[model samples]
Target: MNPALQGLLTIIIGVGGCVGYFYFSNQFLDKVLFPASGPNAGKNINRANIIRPWLFLLPALLALGVYLAYPVVETLRLSLTERLPDGGSAFVGLDNYEQMLDEPKFWEALKNNMLWLLIVPALSTAFGLLAAQLSDRVFWGNLAKSLIFMPMAISFVGAAVIWKLVYDARPIDQDQIGVLNALYIFFGGDSPNNWLTIPFWNNILLMIVLVWIQTGFAMVILSAALRGIPEETVEAAIIDGASPFQVFFKIKVPQIMGTIVVVWTTITITVLKVFDIVFAMTNGQWETQVLANYMYDKLFRSHDWGVGSASAMIIMLLVMPILIWNVYNARKEMQ
Candidate 1:
């Protein structure tokens, strides 16, 4: 078949299949469900009423099941087996989980993940809130916001490389190479330090990379949320003698609590799954490993599929609740 005709046929069939499914499902629901459950027991029925909205929903539901639900199930199943070197394997029920629990590297990665979870979201949201509040009053606020948000446009690997140069170091005898170390030397510091080799602090340094990338996202969303806050509410608070700080705390924060949660949760999820920066900069070497990088090490570097899948499952398990809460909160807000 000609490519154009094939494409046309595919679209026609796709639309026909969707229309057919929605028409049948809507009929089934109205006949079986509404008669028994809905208040309209004796209402007139029409095909237009039955299938109008579901026509749009059919494609989305199908895509969700195909792209999201099926892969999750496959990943869960993959988590339970070990793949061997000679293309052979055996079932290992929780053995991978046991190994992961016993590994120091896994624990370190988990610890770093915890640190990321604690630090990045809080810092990003705090800084975003402050930026939002400050920008609200500035004359050229849009320009300032554009500048602040520009970092978010850089790829994670690019950002990591940029920061890598900033954190780069030279021997104390020689000139300090890294921007940070150079700044220190300029300030009369004695020696240059290897920033990435520093434990715990290195984790914080890695987190600053994420915060740099995500703060712009947080700022954009939060600034919009702040702008959405009604002038009447601020005026009312002022009329009742609320100080600026008091009004901000009691009124503004409470009003945008949903957006705050959203920003925090979004960054938290990103932090949990972070791999690119760590891999690009540290390659999970030194003390800079995170959960996603840990999983990558097991899956690819070590060829330990079971352990990798298990860690992937763990990440999914950690993220599912936040995702569920996000959905619930969004629904509640919409209602």
Candidate 2:
């Protein structure tokens, strides 16, 4: 077999299996095990109804445990142990953590990741909000939103390839190719600069890729939130001698703050795990290392499972607070 065919068959089998299980289990409960025609029919039916939901949910919970919870637990265990030279593993406690903390590259990646966490979510949200607000006023609002939101559909590697070309640099003697370099030369600059090779600025250029892709997601969500706002509120604000800026900032924005925070936290998670753009464009070279790429390098290139898993745990720790807050909000909403 073909790999694609095998995958298709596997998916078909999985779905068929789940459907068969549900149908047969429900039939068994209703007809054979707990017949609705029995003397205790009403009690049996109520019990069956309660148990049926769990029967359906059991497979999902098992899958989650096996696929998600298992890996996290295993990774934590691996992070606490180091592989010996003969391919044997030994418990090392916090040695891996100490080793990672000692590396300057890890620290560099940590700093860059922090900066990314701070900047990407904020900028992406801002650009998204601006696009959402402006596009709503235009006659071709849907078309504009479509164009703006189009980037979100592009894969990270594809987006990286597109941006790499945009940031490409050719010699001044030859025809300039990169847009930035071309613009630079056109405005009377020195030479075509390789943007990705530069230090802090290169990271900025890499971040711009994520920002571009994320802006559309932010825009679509915020646009919906904005649409949900009552027109009467805006009219009331206007009647009270409020400027457009005042209406947007004071009235509209306050109403949509929840959506904005949701967007922010959502993008924050993406930024924490951002790997593809940096990997495709720079590969964490020239002081541009981020936690994800660093973990990748440690796991594969250096063949250090201990350090890689430790880095993963760090990423998980960073993400935990947001997860808690989201769960808290969800529970509160339920109440």
Candidate 3:
């Protein structure tokens, strides 16, 4: 079948089904169950009215149950079971969790993820706030913002590929191609450094990729928050002998602090789930392992479903608090 025809048929069937269901359900409630013209009609009508909203909501609730809730429950189940050689799963309780804790690589990945959680969101938000402030003061501000934000349009793997070349290494005797090596040699360095191969610093280098991508997102959001600040507050600060820095930090930042926090937590969630950059650049080699890649390595490469699911649960646990906090803040603001 033609793709467009299939899509059109899907739309027609979906809409028609929804319409038919609602109409028929309402008729059944009024004519059969509720019986609007009969005795006890008022009570029946009240009952139907109360149940109507849930009827509309039932499809969505079921969809969420199937898609979102099921995966979490299934993953939790998988985490607690050992994959047997006979294509069966045997319940092993917390053995997977214990084994994961015993592994040095798991600890290393957790440590690197902690480093990412600490660095990426903070650096991205700081850079974004700085750029948001500075860009507004420049004549070519929009163009500058565009240039800064261009990296956000690039995929993580694409950005990794781009930076991979920038960090690329050539032998000392050959003409250097990598930007870092070329600069190093120009400054009288003896040998070209393979930047990604260095352990602790390599993690920082990989994090720079995510920071570069996320800064623009932070900037755009922070920029809007900045613009929304009342001019009178800034003017009042300036009139009271406050310096530019004082006005910005004391007035503007306090006002947009909520927005700043939202951006930070948003990026933090991204950092926790970071995988592609590490996967593409180092494949979690050179001590740059993050939780997502760690989970992938366990689940796919090692074919250890139990340990892999445990790692996944750990990542979810880390993210859940931040997710809940973000939603809480949003609801508070709405209220």
* Highest lDDT scorer: 2
Best by TM-score: 2
Which residue ranges in model 3 land beyond 4 Å of their true spot? 1-48, 330-335
Candidates arranged by lDDT, highest first: 2, 3, 1
CA lDDT of 52 in candidate 1?
53
Off by over 4 Å in 1: 1-63, 84-88, 330-335
Prediction 3 TM-score vs. true: 0.88
Q: Looking at model 2, report the run of 10 residues with the lowest lDDT sum.
A: 29-38
Q: What's the TM for model 2?
A: 0.96
* All candidates: TM-score: 0.80, 0.96, 0.88
Model 2 misplacement above 4 A: 39-43, 85-88
Q: What's model 1's lDDT at 73?
A: 91
Q: What alpha-carbon RMSD in Å does predicted model 2 have with respect to the real structure? A: 1.5
Q: In angstroms, how far off is 208's CA in candidate 3? A: 0.6
> For residues 41-125, could you state the per-residue lDDT of candidate 3 as single tens digits?
8898898898888878888899999998998999999999998889988999999999999999999999999999999999999
